[model samples]
Target chain A: MTAPRSTTTNEPTDPYVDLPVPDQRKQQSWRAQGPIVAMVALGGAVGASARYGASMVWPVAAGSFPWTTLWVNAVGCAVIGVFMVLITEVWAAHRLVRPFFGTGVLGGFTTFSTYALDIQKLVAGGHSRAGLAYLAATLCAALAAVWLAATVTRRLVAWRQR
Target chain B: MNWLLVICGAVVGAPMRYLTDRAVQKRHDTVFPWGTFTVNVVGCLILGLLSGAVATGAASSHVQLLLGTGLCGALTTYSTFSYETLRLAEDGARFFAAANVVASVVAGLGAAFVGVSCAEALWA
Candidate 1:
């Protein structure tokens, strides 16, 4: 079972995890998810509000390099790295915590739409250098931030466990 | 107030994302994270159209605040995308991890451009 699980024709990315079929999923009523949904919504409110507030405090004019959004996404990605590490190894986070803080807050805070559009606008406005830079920089920064944060967190957690 | 509009939009967008993710995940057992990919691309598309509409005077600033800043912002997520990519790489799925990054960026950017062009055609 273990051999087939990891070495099947499917790549490592295709997990062997079982998922609920449509019929089984239909059995899960929406009303049953009220609390989880509420937590996600509440966390989203706080996260989105924070992001909007950032824009207000350091407003970037249109057609400019959207440094604010880039930083926001990078910071959010870093936080998620720490958060996920803690939840997985250090703390057995509450079930709601993952959905609320992880999915809702972080997800709300770091935006892909804005990133894409920033590139589009910059390129369209003839600031192709800034556009290309923003595109690559955001991706690199966000990914590096997450990877670094996670690795550091894991090391810290291991030391603490020791 | 501005905060209230954003909060209102976020409350809807966030839950919509959670629900959509759950729904999408339930149908697939892959660890490739198609759920996040779908939401990110869809969000970019909507935001693209909304931006174009605003530029063409078809959409108001308030709408942009509600839908673009709050809804679309909450709908798409760079944090989750990067995190998932890291996970894939760490788990020895380097190819999948790279594919996820490229596909998400390309598709999301494509969607944004398409939405804008569509809006410009209709409005401009």
Candidate 2:
């Protein structure tokens, strides 16, 4: 998502590198998708397992705030910010690397579904305050984490390159 | 056993997300990230339904572990969503960044609630 399209005012966010060229989608044949999809799957398994393991190790008690998931999501968001910057700007790595690590592993590791569901459960369980707090906190934390991480990573990369 | 179920579900769920993202993204040329948006909402909906079903005994814990914990968890992602939003802001598309966050949260929460109600009507 860090594609340098900001030079032109009309340029849209060329977010994901995997997106096929507009009107040239036919070029992205099914064959090109095989390895990317496989890598995503493989990375996904590792990510989901790690998440499950974390929850197992630090199980959120019934009716308690889901701090574990909040941390997981925040950490994932931070890591992604750094990773996206490095992968898109600094690293000239393999193509499959982004799809595997970024889209697959981190995506699987941090879940929006559980976050939403947890808030729902908290509210339904007579913990509306906790739900509201969590709802706001996770959003704030995720955004802040990504913003700070990306900023710092960019600075570090620039310094090293200089 | 539970770990295996989660892994199996993730093996399928992650790829499903990638392919779905590709399919959705290729359809449009906008940078709004509708691909991630769609999957998050859909995943929340399914997880909500499963939660309701479990609450009402319509689904077992095993199924919940497979579908809810593994499938929905892998299908929807906070990292990508946040990263894209960050990119939009960095690229000076501030409006899109704000809208992306607001819309995703509202839609995701709404879908979760709707799914729960639907499940309550159907199974509960």
Q: Which is the leading candidate under lDDT?
A: 2
lDDT of each candidate versus the true structure: 0.84, 0.86
lDDT of 2 by residue, B3-64 (tens): 99999888888888888877786666566778899999999999999999999999999999
- Candidate 1, residues B59-109: lDDT per residue as tens digits? 999999999999999988899899989988898878778889999999999
| lDDT tens digits, residue span A23-66, model 2 | 44655655677788898999888899999999999999979989
Off by over 4 Å in 1: A1-28
Residue pairs in candidate 1 whose N, alpha carbon or C atoms collide under 3 angstroms: none
Assess each model's interface with DockQ, reporting 2 decimals per model. Answer: 0.60, 0.60
Under the 3 Å rule for N, CA and C atoms, how many clashes does model 2 have?
0
